[model samples]
Target: MCDQYRKSYRLGRRPGEQGPRPLSRNQDRVEKLATGTATTTTTKTKPTTDSSTANATTTNSSTANPSITILTTNPTTANSRKTNSTTVNPATVKAKDSSTTTKTITDPGRAKTRKPNQTTTNLTTANSATANSATTNSTTTNSVIVKTRDSVTTNTTGTSTRPARITNKSTITITKVPKCKTQKLKITKNTLTVGTWNVRTLWAAGKLDLLRHEMNRYRYDIIGISEVRWTGKREIPRGDFIWSGENSNHIRGVGILLSTKAKKSLMSYNPINSRIIMARFNATPFNVTIIHAYAPTSDSSEDDIETFYNCVEEAIEKVPKKDVIIITGDWNAKVGTDNTGWESVMGRYGYGSRNERGERLLEFAAEHNLFICNTRFQQTSNRKWTWESPDGIHKNMIDLVIVQKRWKTSVTNCRTFQGADISSDHSLVLCNIKLKLKNKPRHNQRYDVSQLKDQTTRQSYQARIEDNLKNIHSTCNLNEHAAQIEKAVKEALQATVTLEKTSKKSWIFDQTLDLTDKKRKAKQIKHLSADSIKEYKNLCNKVKNRHDRTKKSGYKINVKKLKKDYKLATAEKRTVW
Candidate 1:
């Protein structure tokens, strides 16, 4: 027990950063101990007359509490006999070394503070060797704060394991508080459901509502929508749905819908153009930026393709180097099963044969070091295809989800959901990825400084600051004085300005959404019957025409409002000047 305690105390000090501690005589002992070398020293003392002579003492004293035993021998003058016995609490004895250093070990169970070059070891009720306060050095091993507790075990690697036990005996559990309470919590992200679909046009009546139902059914964190056909740029938030889009001609449009979970981590969404949109999320260790695109069809001009790719490249370049990027949308490309030299970006599970569009996409992905997630996972023929012909005779996998090659393993599954009813020719292509949301520090509350524009408010604020400064004038410490000054300024500003709550307004009507759903169901029925095709087409045209007029009316109202606001602002500016 004494040997074990001494070893634990001595080894507590970490090795020097300049490499091993020059392997001195003392360090040799440490190395031997580390290598399981067993060496012991023993000393015997002899008593003569009435004096007790000292035994050979070690230069390094043991850290454990010591029990000193003194033996005295006295010659009996009359009887000529000798008696030997032990006495406790003997006089404090200091062992002398060649360097004139004195070593002292206190009484058992009473540990003392360790010296600069000293260490301490103690035994708990369970007789385990534990360091009282081990000083850290250059060793990679972490220092652990150990406490005596029943049914508690700690490892040196900074991990603790607690097993479940059913016992009738009452027990008290004491856990050691972590050294740093402000340490960030470890964030672990599991499988996330992401999807993309090209819903011919979001301008159709009730398309957003029908889309919401499908989104809720799949419980997707984020889903990209293409061909939205919505004019202008804006962010629309309804219930748990949030989307951002930009379109000028009401032609091909792209947008992304985020669930409540994703919304909580939503940093910002940028509407790049009618065919492209980007949203960033606060997934940490690396942020995740999802870019939604509606690439031009194969028949589009080469210049159009070049422009589209240029936009895509610009978007990718905008993301930070440390963040993970995912570009998922309808690429209108068909990459066949032959991975060949493109094994890094694709897999053998790809459906159909490679085409000109597919080659372009492959080249883009290779340049960006991205992997197509759809081709990474294997599935059935129906599950692999994302687009089908109107007559349902032809099927192709045009829509795809691509992620950074470095995070390819984060994509657990990528396939099409053949069952989603979004009243579109394209199937919903879903990709599952694992990404953790970082817990960022909350924004500090700020008072409105605009209130300072008023003369009365400005005077009141100045008076408050003066009053606060007077109250904190007694503070002498430099840090304290600065803190008081800051506090005073903040309080004075807060007293002048009250916080206001603002929310965005929605322009689309619920009735219009209902009509869009009716129109969608009619289209679905028309596909099933050759006779009802004409009626279905007529109903679609009617719905489209009505929505077109509604959009035009809404635009006119917005233009008039803008003109009025501009006039009022101009008059106010002239009066102020």
Candidate 2:
């Protein structure tokens, strides 16, 4: 009995205590304890300590008045022996009717309290009524404790007539969002076909027609013509032929034939000399500058060759550096198969042996950083050679389509078309280039002005103009007034006159076309005997004679028509006078 009494006293229990004793006395002195310890104790008439804690002290209170005590500890201090205690007086705490109090505590930590890094959270809520309802005292005591070194946070919620005070540091964090990105548009590409043909002579009768026929057949956007013996520089709108030659007499000349499409995009053209003619077109990505050149023969003097190349260089210098420069013509220089020293300027697929003129061409190409597109593609001997000897024994690849080395990829393919016959010993050298050309707007609207000659039509036009002008009041601005007048005139013309319907008339007879076709076929024959050559020459002469006759007859017919029109105009003038 005496030993039992001593044990109870050491365990913080009185000798006369009747209730069950605590399990251990030193449990309160532990290094770390469980978090969120909650205790509920009922006393009949005296104060009592909870069974969960041995060191918890309580004050005396009436049976009608009950109190709650909460205790918490910091776990950051591994060797900490201190305890934080909080006590609430029954007289101070007040709760409303039908109110709810909720408490939550979170502690995520290892079993060992010696860990340096541990987080703890504590929440406490209490609700109680006024002192008048002390007799029905129903208290819920909830304690939540979390411990850390310097960081401590607590949340307390309760429904009471009085406000509860709290003292703890807290931290909050905020985040942000990001934005979106935009997209890009796709660009379209187009193909431009550029060709070079050595038409021996445009000065010959019916030669321009043959050239146009071949151009239409091949669908070439631009074809550079060499050895065009046309005297003086002129632009023929019939076939969009822009040629440059000797001012005095028929000699070596260069020209460029443009399709309707090419004509629309043609910005400007320069007739440098009889040997060189340049034309520039507005295209997408870059403008195109085409220089059609007719170089002197290989047997020519060095001074002549130098002078020709100097003129070509001057033309190139005039072109904008950013423009796509395409030099197409009959160079009359053979750059052979070997591309050892001139690998950058010429390719290995070239035909025949290189000559002195070829060496000069290679030097010029290298100096200008240009690529000979003809020599860049592999083709058979027949397709590779651009010109043949008179006896058909010797042939050479002289004509070339040269382009800037930087834009070599733009030239997809370059080769000779042997089937295209323009009464020339040389074959047509064509090149396919990828380019996006700008659309040219048509400005020339050909109205039937001949309708104005009719008296009734003239009166109708005058009446329409008067009606339009009546509605268009003159504005203070001169420009506006002029624009109104122009609009009125245009509207009157639109109402009275019609657009001239141009009927395309083929000038050459079918017999002449058939003869030309036969000539082309005979030239294409692989094995041409003496009889075939004689036949080809005879056919050429016949075609030329027929062309001369047709030309003269057409000229006489035009002169007669002009005389009749002049007479009619003079008679009308005399009647009006």
lDDT per residue (tens digit) for residues 478-505 in model 2? 8888899888998899899999866556
The TM-score obtained by model 1 is: 0.50
Task: Write down the lDDT that model 2 would get.
Answer: 0.67
Candidate 1 Cα errors over 4 Å, as ranges: 1-189, 237-247, 439-577
Model 2 superposed RMSD (Cα): 26.5
lDDT of each: 0.62, 0.67
Give the candidate number with the greatest TM-score: 2
> What is the Å distance of residue 334 in model 2 from its true position?
1.1
| Colliding residue pairs in candidate 1 | 205-516, 206-513
Candidate 1 lDDT tens digits, 1-577 = 2222332223333432222224343333322222221122222222222123233333233212112321111111212322221211122322111211122322233221111121111111211132222211112122122223232233444333322221211111111111222333354456566778998877765467557755766758888888888877776634244344443467787878877677667787788887888888888567889999989998999899989999999999999888889898999889988999999999889988889999999999999899999898778997898888877777888999999999998887899887666667898888888876653343555466777889999999999999998999674799889999999998898788765433544455566566665765675567677877777667666656666676677789899998888889898885422
